[model samples]
Target chain A: MVRWEPGTPERLQRAALELFATRGFEETTAAEIAQSVGLTERTFFRHFADKREALFHGQELFVRAFVAGVEAASPTASPIEVVAAALASAAEFFPDERRSHSRVRQSVIGRNPALQEREVHKMASLAAALADAFRARGVADPAATLAAESGVTVFAVAFVQWLREGEERSLGEIATEVLGELRALTSAV
Target chain B: MVRWEPGTPERLQRAALELFATRGFEETTAAEIAQSVGLTERTFFRHFADKREALFHGQELFVRAFVAGVEAASPTASPIEVVAAALASAAEFFPDERRSHSRVRQSVIGRNPALQEREVHKMASLAAALADAFRARGVADPAATLAAESGVTVFAVAFVQWLREGEERSLGEIATEVLGELRALTSAV
Candidate 1:
C-alpha cells in the first residue's frame, strides 16, 4: 500500500505542469511526472486519471464554489447579478500564485486539439452546472441557460485577459469588467 | 468516375439522417448510408468527409451567411446588432422543411458525447468566425468576442426551444425572443 502524505498532490501537479511546459504534453509520461516528484506512478494515477487531467485540477472545486455562490445569492438578485456572484466565487480558485502556471497550462492546451476539445468540454460542463444552479433558484428555461452560458463566456474572456503577459488585474476584476461589457452589449440590443 | 449529380448531396444527407435516427449514430456506417440512398460509397465520400458531416451539411453555408450579414450591416450598427443580423441571416439556411430533420439530428447529437464535443467545437468555431468578422469591421477586442459568443449562446438557446414538439415559432422569432431576454437579464443587473 502507498503511504498518503501531505503536499504530494501539489508536488505532483507542479512537476507535471513543468514537464508539460518543457517537454510537451504528449511527450511527458505519467511515470516521468511521478519520478520528477519522487513518487510512484500509482500515486500519480491516484491523484489524476491521466496527464491531461493534471492541468484541470480544481475544476470540480471551482464548479462547486460557483454553484454554491449562486445558491447563496439573494433571491431578488437578477440572473446576471447571480451569475456575476458565482463567477466571483469561482475566481477564488485562481489565486495570484497560480497565474503563471495557468498561463503555461493554457499554452500547452492551445497547442493540442485534444486538449482544446477537453477545455471546451470543461467550459460546457461549467455552463451546464451553472444553469442547473439557476434552475434550482426558480429561474425559467431560456433565461437560466442563457445567463449561465453568458457567465461562462464572460469567465473565459476574463480569464484570457487576466493571463496575458504584463497584466496586473485580478481574475475577479477582469471578470467584473467583462461582465459589465456583456451587459452593455446586451442592453444595446 | 463518380457522376457529380444534382441533389446527390441532399439525398445522401437525408439517407444518413434516417440511418442515424433509426440505427443509432454509432451503429450507422457511411457505406450503409450510401447504399440506403442507392448510391455508391464513393459518392458519399465526395460529398462528406465522414458520417457526422452528413448531419452538418449546411454549417459552412450558415457560417458564410453569418459573416456576409455582419459585413453588410449598417456601419453604425452596434456589435450586438450586427451579431443579431448575422444570426437572422443564418436563420435563412434552416427553412421549415428542414425542421424535422434538425430535431432528429439534435437528438442524435445529444445522445453521443463525441457528437456533443463536435457540436461545442462547431459553436466555438462560429463564435470565432463572428469575432473575426467583427474585428474586420473595426470592432475591438472583448466587445467583438463577447458579442459573437453571446450570439452563439442566444442561437443555441433559441434553437432548442424552436425544436420543441409542436412549437409554432420560427427560428428567427425564437432567437429574437432569447436575445430580448438576454437584454432584459443584463439590463436588470
Candidate 2:
C-alpha cells in the first residue's frame, strides 16, 4: 500500500494563502510556501500544478457539492427546483471559518485580470457540468442550460454578498434568499 | 479630416477569416492576411489589434446590441422583460447573411483555448456594463447583477443554437423562444 500524506495539501494551502495575502501573490514563490509548510517544493508541485492551483484547492469540492445536490434532488423536481438544490449544496462548502480566507483570495483574484478570467472560466465549467447533470436527470434543452447557468450566476451574486463586510448570514441562507429573488425576477417576465 | 475608409475593416476581416480558415490560424500571419486583401500590415493593425482580433470583428457590435436594448427598453418593463428585449436586440445582430461567417468564426474560436478565454472575458465585460445600465434605471444591487449575468448566459446558449447545423430559425426567433422556456423553467419553481 502506498503511504498516505494526510493534510499535506491543506497545510500547504493555508501557508500559501497567508503568504499571498501578506506579501502579495506575485511576490510569493512555491518553494517559499513549501518551505514554510515544512515540505519540499516537489511535494507542492505533486499536490498542485502551481501556486495558483493551490489557492483554488477547494475548487473540486465546490463542484462536487453542486453535483451531489443534483443527485440528491427529487426525481420529480422541476429544472429550477433541481438547480435550487445545487445552490444550497454549493453554499454549504463555505462555513464561517473559511470566509476570511475566501475574502482574501477574492481580493487577490480581483487584483489580477488573468485571475479574474480564470474565475469566469471556472464558473463556465461549473455551469457546463451542472447542465450535464440536469441532462442526466432527464431534463431537456434550453431548460437545462438556463437552469444551470442561472444557478451558477445566483451562486456568484450571493457569494459576493457573503464576502461583503457586515453581512452576518450564512452562505446557504444568502443563496436561498437570492434564489427566491431570482425566481421572482423570472416570474415577472 | 481623416480619410473615409468605409469598407476597409470589413474587407480585412473577411480576408483574415478566409486565410485563417484555409491556412490554419497558427500558420496564418498578419502580413499575409493584409496582403490577401490588398492592404498593408500597418493598415490591418490600425483596424484590428492583431489577426486574432480580426476574426472577432463583430464582438463590439454584439455587446452594443445588449446595451442598446437596455437603453431602448420601456421604463416600466420588469428586469426580465428588459433582458428579453436585450436578447431580441442581440439576436438581430445575427442575420441570415452573418450566420455563415459566424459559423466559421465560431469554429475558429473553438479551436483555441486562449481565444475561448477571451470570449468569456468579453462576455463578463458585457455583463458588467449591462449591470451598470440596469442600476442607472433604478434596479438594485443583486437584481441588476443577476439580470445582466442571466441575460448574457441566455445569449450564449441561444447563440449556440443559432450556430447549429440545419437550424433554420432566425436568431431572434430562437432567442425569443428560448427566453419563453427560461420563463417557464423559473415559473415551475
What's the DockQ for every one of the candidates? 0.80, 0.78
**How far in Å is the alpha carbon of B160 misplaced in model 2?**
1.0
Which stretches of candidate 2 lie above 4 Å from their native place? A1-6, A38-43, B1-9, B38-51
lDDT of 2 at B21: 78
Per-residue lDDT of candidate 1, residues A1-189 (tens digit): 999765877788888889988999889999999999888999999999988887778778888988888998999998988988998998888888989988998898998888898899999999999999999999998889988998999999999999999999899999999999988887784
Native contacts recovered by model 1? 0.95
DockQ agreement of candidate 1 with the native complex:
0.80
What's each prediction's TM-score?
0.91, 0.90
Residue B128, candidate 1: Cα error in Å is: 0.5
User: Per-residue lDDT of B58-112 in model 2, one digit per residue for the tens?
Assistant: 7778888889999899999999999999888888877888898889988988887
**lDDT tens string, model 1, B61-178?**
7788878889999999999889789889877777778799789989989988888998998888898999999999998999999989988898889889889999988999888888
Off by over 4 Å in 1: A1-12, A38-49, B1-10, B38-50
